[model samples]
Target: MTSPEVDFTRRNPTARPLTDKERDALDEFVDSIHYSSRYNDDHYEYRHVQLPKQMLKKIPKEYFEPSRGTLKLLWEEEWRGLGITQSLGWEHYEVHEPEPHILLFKRPMNYQPPAQH
Candidate 1:
């Protein structure tokens, strides 16, 4: 008989909390994957993340349909805090998915963030 597939998103039942050193290492790794500038310019810093087919399959079917608005909504959700302005923010940003399951995000590197409310 075949064993059930593992769901990676769920933490293992016997997992232990990260030690201080491990936490620091994880933080450094996260920083390394954050926004990176493609070109030396005042305009933008870019970053991207690729979703594997398994993860993409978990999303709703409508999100993958051929609609510009639906596509933008997906981008918006992925880019909520990166830098896009909605009602009260100074910085502007953009998102693109040039390839299936690949999301590219860019935001101005020179602009100051909006004041806290």
Candidate 2:
């Protein structure tokens, strides 16, 4: 809820168009590293993917029945099927869509390059 980026204020400055180089770089960057584990190698990348229906059916009964917040979290897990443990394991979840399901989980943070020397 409190991201520093939220503090930026362009207010009403004139909208200058993007530069050609910036535009090209932006295009290339966008085209490069992308979404979809199906497209890229799962090597070390950890993703939040939706678990397949077959796999999801095996979730614990308690997990299968989630509360509002927990259901939302389960929805994400089911949607993303989150990749975990170096592609070895995945967190299971369930969503009680009729009502709101609430659950708490500690997810791995997105990857960050190591600091340069």
Candidate 3:
């Protein structure tokens, strides 16, 4: 079966297209994570284990992984951390970090942004 495609535009309808460097960084960041994907008829689901802080150092600072408070808000609001996903073209379905050094992320294949006028 074919891998699910990332609908970049759907991540943020009003956002501009990603620059080559931005795309490269995002690809690198995504690749660094250990992840697994499962596909159901409706959508693809992904679970990504957190990368070490040192590994994330190369990524842009704006995309700081997630703070505990931020993770709480994301769970309470059913929203992803925009800072982390802003350039990645993805959003978190769930986030759990039992300890400071360990984190787990769940994300759906599609990211649907609000309609833009």
Candidate closest to the true structure, highest lDDT: 3
Write one digit per residue (lDDT tens) for candidate 3, span 1-117.
443443332222332333567555455445445444433334544444455454434433333334432122122112222223332334344334453323334334575656779
Which regions in candidate 3 have their CA more than 4 angstroms from the true location? 1-32, 37-46, 65-90, 99-117
Q: Model 1: per-residue lDDT, tens digit, 46-87?
A: 455444434344344444435432222333432332222232
TM-score sort, best first? 1, 3, 2
How many angstroms is residue 63 displaced in model 3 relative to the true structure, after the best TM-score fit?
1.9
lDDT of 2 by residue, 3-31 (tens): 11211121112223334543443342232
Query: What TM-score would every model get versus the actual structure?
Result: 0.41, 0.24, 0.32
Best by TM-score: 1
Alpha-carbon lDDT, every model: 0.37, 0.29, 0.38
Candidate 3: residue pairs that collide: none
For residue 71, what is the lDDT in candidate 3?
27
Best of the two (1, 3) by lDDT = 3
